[model samples]
Target: MTTVMCMKLACMTECTRQGIACMLTRTVPYATVPSFQKQDLNRTMDLGLAEDHFSRPVGSFVASDIEQLKLAIEECKKLILELPEHSERQKDTVVKLIHLRLKLQELKDPEEDEPNLRILLEHRFSKEKSKSVKQTCDKCSTIIWGLIQTWYTCTGCYYRCHSKCMNLITKPCVRSKVSHQSEYELSICPEIGLDRQDYRCAECRTPISLRGVPSEARQCDYTGQYYCSTCHWNDTAIVPARVIHNWEFEPRKVCRSSMRYLALMLSRPVLRLKEINPLLFNFVEELVEIRKLRQDILLMKPYFITCKEAMEARLLLQLQDRQHFVENDDMYSLQDLIDISSGRLSCSLTEIHTTFAKHIKLDCERCQAKGFVCELCKEGDILFPFDSHTSVCHDCSAVFHRDCYYDNSTTCPRCARMTERKQDDISDVKEA
Candidate 1:
């Protein structure tokens, strides 16, 4: 009777413990599995199951599916914690976790179902001011007559879309200054064929057929990527790659992204033409003249920076639109090249150069005092390093008449005197 009582007491205690364990499992949201049982869960985080959840054609996820996804995400996080950091397996698990979380968020958030959109970058949209030019929505392929339908244009990229379609644009605006400021893709229409892109639109991943059975694929000249009609819309823009590699100014058909990127890069002054294609300057007469003018601008910048009177008068503001011209001689923006071709930039620079020259040479005595005298000619007339008729010494930076420099066998008088003085000092040091 004593032995029976002891066994019954132990049995009752075990049952109570088991009931409490069940309660804990039900209460804990993220009940972690024991290390020994993790092997059993290797098949629980099925990638195919996650892909199926995302690949659903049209309907929202059911409550049960969402709950399952949350559980799977928790499982994935636990698995990730067990793996070594930055390992390939851990990385893959992390990606799966992200997908699961995105799926869960999409299911829970009703905003994802709404037509309102978001983009990869910010776009500053303003009222479409031009009434005469017929514009179209970059998002939807529809003409936007300014007088009839209200629209907005992105001041950054010149992206025009209907007022309703503004929120619908998912493509980012061109922020060339923030991205690709120094480096530009120079290959001319470096198109990876449709086979390489798997015959899909680069932006939207929409199916594109070669023969236009369902959707036609269009090529963007700038990016060399294929796009569907909705993303292309037959928009034309001068490709920077073509301009750099082939010097082709003829506008070519590009996708919406390329169009916006080029428009924003128009006046950015990021391209170093001399570094990219020095041969262009030799062929294009305007480039040659522009280079000379830029050199003169560079020389004038120091005088403007130093003179209190020049600063007070805001002399540098004359080239406010082309501030980079004063900063460096080689960098030329795409718009600068276009304006040069049309004689607009040349005329504008000529006017600015005249104004600068008047101040540096004739107007400001302080600026005139900074001018270089021709050492070879020994003339009272001041010579500037930027003067076309002058030659600057390589060693001492002394200016002289080009003809006089050649006659003097390119010998600088100042450098010669300094060399003599150095030799005399060396002789005295040796004697001492």
Candidate 2:
């Protein structure tokens, strides 16, 4: 049977060599198992014939024709087989190359009947150009593309930035309770070349923008005034004279507008009363004289009598005259007079006597009764024996019983001191 098959194969090879088209077809009944079996056999035979044709060398095959693709596939298969057994990746690469070659062959042939490759290429190129034409971010000279939903752009440069970078350039989104409008305000960032010439509060160092100010308003706590809210409230130079007098004398009535004029005039370093309103010019001149006299008194005497203190003295004198009180009367002590003179205590003698009667304790050293407890410990049981002026920390107020090393120590657990030298060093490092 092997000898017979060899003879038949040789005859078929000779026939194919002679340039005769070999026609090997078999017919069978449609409703028979032999028909399906014959179809399968024919398919296997056709595949064998195709494989035999592709097994030829490239030079032997017809070049510049569709038949060259069959030769290329054979060459790819041979190259894959020549690679090392473990080189599966190389085999796949060769397979892809074969597929690309087949595609190129399809693209070259007009009679092959396929879509025009030039049109597809043009369409793809145009799409890419349109996508890449827009401006992109260059963060440290790196281009970022696409319409990032959460990103924002710089108004000047049109460079796309992350939300956080945009926020750094702009102000924080603070919600206002009174104003229902949603405002998008940008804060000036000096680092990013935004305007930063606006003034800030000297005490708190908070930025003061001019946008919120009314046109008539010239003075502000945060801006050129350089005074924070707390500092402004405590400023004696700018406070109205009526307010100052009211703090010293409770029962007196004063003109508000006149007091404001006086405060404004006093705040100036150099002033002439003639330049002000003519009606109050004489009063202003008198006030200037009184201020000079008070200054002379303070210079000559050890005790300081401020404007508030003088006002309190005037009120006391008025009260003394009204009540027909005698100077050396045994009805009241010097301590009682001092308390009334301060204007902090109630003027009513009965109330003053009652308050002192409950809290006063006799000092052991002076043998005198005192109402004030120790300014440091605030223990009413022990009276402060020392009469010297003392300053203490607000937290503990722990005054030394006697002069000691701890009294000189300003370092506290609550509030630590930061020197100008340390702040200067920090600023230098930040600049560097």
Best by lDDT: 1
Worst 10 residues of 1 by lDDT: 21-30
Model 1: lDDT of residue 82: 70
Q: Judged by TM-score, which candidate is best?
A: 1
Q: Each model's number of backbone clashes?
A: 0, 0
| lDDT tens per residue, model 1, 1-432 | 234334433332334333423322221111364565346345443533223445335766678877787778777767767765554455445544544554564555433323333233577776655553245677787655443345677666767787667656777667744464545568888888988888889998889977885799888888788899999878899888778767778999988777766776678888888778888877888889988999888977888899988999998898889888888888888888889888999998999889988888899999989998877778858988777898888888788888898888745898999899999999999999
Q: How well is each residue in 1-432 modelled by candidate 2, as lDDT tens digits?
A: 234334433343333321222222222233542553455334433433223333334342245544555555565554445444444333332433333343333333222222222111111111111122133322222222221112333322233432223323322111221123321111111121112324443333345433523211123211224322322332222222222222222222212221222232332222222232234324334333333322332221211122343344342343342231212211222223224446332335434333322322231222233223443334434332222233334454333333331454545432333355568889999999
TM-scores of all candidate predictions against the true structure = 0.64, 0.13
Q: Per-residue lDDT for 264 in model 2?
A: 28
